[model samples]
Target: MTLTKSLLLGTSGALLAVAGAQAADLPSRKAAPVEYVRVCDAYGAGFYWIPGTDTCLKIGGRVRIDTWYTPAKSAVQLRSTGGPAYTGVPGGGTASSTYTSANGIDQLGWYARGLLMMDARTQSGWGTVQTVVTLRLAAQTGLAQAGQLSSVPLAVAGTTGATIEAAYIRFAGFTAGQAASNFTFLPSNQYHSIWSPSFPSGIRQFAYTATFGGGISATVALENMGDLAAATTANSLGFNPYSATAATATAVAPQRLPALVGNVRIDQPWGAAMVSAVVLQNNANFATPGIQAVTNGLGPLVRKTGWAVSAGLRINLPMLATGDSIQAWVSYGVGALNYTAIPNLNANTATTANYTGGFLRGDRDMTIYCVGVGCASYGVEQAAALNIAGVFTHYWTPSLRSNLVGSYIRLTPGSTTRNTDWTNGGLSSATGWSVQTNLIWSPVRNFDIGIELSYARLQQSLTGLNGAAPTAVPCTAAAPMCNASISPSNWTGRMRVERTF
Candidate 1:
C-alpha cells in the first residue's frame, strides 16, 4: 500500500510539472495603447489634430475640366493670284491679296486640371501662425496647346505639366512668399475667362497689413518686378534682334529694385471698397554687339518709372435678390501699360490671324529709337493706358446663378520718333473690349458646372502703315478697296465642371 501511494503521488507531480512547462512556452496576448486622431475646432471645419502632436491640419483639393470654342481659333485666310482675294475674315484680319498655302487654325480646345492644397495652423504667443500650399497639374488640347510659347515642339498634341500656384505663410499680420498682389481689388471671376481685365496675378513678395480697428485696413508690399520687364521687352523691335535691320532697339535691363505697392480697404455688411496703387521702375540698356555699331553708341538706355492707380467698389443687393451683387473698378497707368491689360500685342488672342491684326503692333509700355544711317543714338518713351471693368452676379435659385461681366482697355504710346517708326512698322494705338454672360449650376455640395458665352472686339487706328492689302473686292458697295481701319470681332464659348473637397 505504501509503494502504491508514493507512485500515485509521483505521477501527479510529473503531470503538474508538464502543464507548468507548457504554460511557460505559450505566447502572451497584450496590446499597446492607441493614439487616435482628435478633432480641432479652434480653426474651421475639416481640421483635425495630428496624432501625438499639437499642430492642426486641413487637406483639400479640386478637380476641374474645361472646354472652349472661339472664332479666333478657327478663322483662316485664303489667297489667290494677283495680290490677295477677300477670304472670309471669320476671326479678323485684312484680306490679303497675297495667296499662300492654307494655314491651320484652332477653333476648339479642352483643358483638365487637378489642384491640391494644404493648410496648417497653430496658436502661439505672438499670434496665429498659418501656412498654405497649393499645387496644380494640368493637361490641354487643341488651341490651348497651340498658343504656348515653347521653344521645343510639344511632345504631344497637348501638354501635361505641374505648377506651384501658391505657397505662403502668414504670421502676425505679415505675409511672405508667392501670393496674389494687393493691387488686385474686387476680382470676381476665375482667371480662365477673358472678360476679366488683366490684374496683377501673383508675385513673390513681402507684405504687412495693419488693421485700423474697424473693417478698414491698410497694406504695403514689396513685389518682384521681373514680370513687367518681360512685358516691356516683348515690344522692342530690335531688342533681341535675330537679324539685321530689325529696327535699332534696346533691351530692358534686369530689375534692380522691387515694385512698391499700397492698398486701403473698407469692408462692411453692405459691401466692400478698395483703393490700390503701385510704382514700377523701368530700365533698359543698349543692345550688346549692337545691331548698328555706328548708329547706336554703346551706352545705357534711358531709365524711367511708371505708376498705376485703381479704385473698386462692391455693393451687396440682397434686397433686390438673394446673393446679388455688383462690382466695378477702373485703373489708369503711365509707363505701366500692363496694368491696363494690353501689354503684349497678342497676349489674349487665341488665334494667329487675330494676333496678326492685334490692337498694338509695337511695344506697349515703352519704345526706343536710333538716329543716323546705322542708328546713331537711342532714346526712351513711355506709354499710357486705362482699363475699366464691371461685373454683376445674380442668384436665380438656390443652385443656379448668373453673372454679367465686361472690360475695356485703351492704350496710347508716347509721341516720339520711335512711335512714328512703329506706326510705319504697322503698329498703332488701339482699344479693346470684352463682354460675357455666364451661368452656373450646383446640384450638390462642393461640385459645380458652369458655362459662359463671350464676345470681344479690337479696333485699331489707321495711323500705322498699311497692313496686308485687302482683296480687289470693294470695301463696301459704295466704295472700292478695304476700309482704312481694321476692326475684328470674336465669339467665344466656355464650359467648366469642378469638384472640391
Candidate 2:
C-alpha cells in the first residue's frame, strides 16, 4: 500500500509541474484600459472632455418643420411673388394671369430646416476661450414669413439652400466673426420674428466687452452693416425704398468707415437690461440728376451720417411660473430705418433676414429726386423711423407654455416727392403693426411642438392729399403708379415641430 501511494503522488506532482510550465509559455492578455468619454459638467449638459485634452466640447443639432397658411388676397404678400401687395387685382403676379384656374392664389406654405452646432471651450491664463460653429440646410415652398419675395410664383415648386448660420470665437473680453449685432436685443421669448421689431441682421464684427463686476458690462464693436447682400446703394445702406419707382438713383459713395455699435448691459438673477446706440455713414451722393453728380462736375456730395438708439428691458416672473418673463424694446432712428426691423430692398441674407421684416415702402435714409431725367437739379431729404416691440411668456405648466409677441413701427418719408423712379405720387409717411400668439408643448426636454397665429397691417398717411386715401393721391389714369395710396396687410398661422440634442 505504501509503495503504491508513493508512486501515485510522485507521478501527479510531476504532471502538474509540466502543465504549469506549458501554461506560462502561452501569451498573456490583460483587459484593455477602456477610454470612456468623460462627462464635462463645467460647461453644462451635453459637453464632454475630448480625449487627452483639457478642452470641453459639445456637438448637437436640431431638426425643425414649419407649416403656415395665409388667406388669399392678403395684402401682406408681395405682389411679385404672387401675393397681393399692390391692389391691382386678386391673384396678381401669378405665373399665368388667367391661365391657372382663372383666379386663385396659393394658400399653404411649408419650410423644413436642419441645423448643426459645435462648441469647444478651454481655460487659459487670460480667460475662457470658446469657439462655436453652426450650419443649416433649409427648404421652402409658398411663404408666410416677412420681407420675403420667394413665394408661390417666384419659388414656384420649391427652393433649397444651405448656409453657415454662425461662426464665432471669444476669449477674455473679445469676440470675433459673424454674430448677432451688438446694437439689437432679440426677444428670447418670441417665436415668429415677423411680429417682433428686432434687428435680425447678423453682422461681421470685431468687438470688445469690458465687465465691471456685478453683471454689468459695456461693449463696443466695429461692424460692416453696409456689406449687405449687395455692397452699397443710394438709400438704406444697400436697401432701396419700394415706393421710389421714379426717384433719381443717387450714386453711392464708397464706404469710408464701418458702422460703430456700442451698448451698456446689466444681467442679474431677476432680469436684464440694455441700452445701445449705433452710427453709420450714409454713402449716397445727393445731386439732382441720377449719377450725374459723380460724373458731371457737380463734385462729390457731402456724405451725411445716420444714427439710432435702442433700449430694452426684461423682467423675470418666477413667482408665476418656473420660466415666465416679459421683455420690451424700443428704437428710434434718423435715416437708419434698418434699426427698426423694416425690410430693405436689398436682397436678404442670413445675418439680416430682412425678407421676414415688416414693410415700410417709402421711408429712406436719403431720398433723391431730379427736376427731370439728366437734369443737374437734384435734392435730398432724410427719413426717420420709430419702433416698439414687446413679448410676454407664461408657463402654464412645466411642459406647456405660451408666448404673445407684438410690434409697432412708424415711418416718416420726409417732405419730398420720390416720383422720379416710378412717378407714383408724393411719398408720404406710413405705420405698421404686427401681433402674434403661440402655444407650445414640450413632452420631452429637447423636443417641442407649437402653433402660432399672426396678423400684420400697414397704414399710409397720404398727407400730401390732406388725408388717408386707398385710391390714388394724384391719380392720373394713364400712369401705372397712379393708384399708390393703398395699405397692405395679411394674417397667417403656423405650426412648428422641433427636436434638439
Q: How many residue pairs clash in each candidate?
A: 11, 16
* lDDT, candidate 1, 427-497, per-residue tens: 45667777788899999987989998877676665432223332233344333124323565667678889
54-143 in candidate 2: lDDT tens per residue?
A: 999999998989887665441222121111233232111122211111023556667788989999999999999999888888887755
Worst 10 residues of 1 by lDDT: 76-85
Cα lDDT, model 1, residue 194:
43
- In model 1, the runs with Cα more than 4 Å from the true position are 1-33, 73-103, 146-156, 188-192, 195-201, 229-234, 237-253, 288-301, 342-359, 371-374, 417-426, 464-485
Q: Could you give me the TM-score of model 1 versus the true structure?
A: 0.77
- lDDT of all predictions, in order shown? 0.60, 0.60
Q: CA lDDT of 285 in candidate 2?
A: 50
Candidate 2 local Cα displacement, residue 297, angstroms:
14
Model 2 misplaced stretches (Cα beyond 4 Å): 1-34, 74-105, 144-155, 195-201, 227-232, 235-247, 250-253, 285-302, 343-364, 371-374, 418-426, 463-485
lDDT score, candidate 2, position 10: 100
Clashes of 2: 16
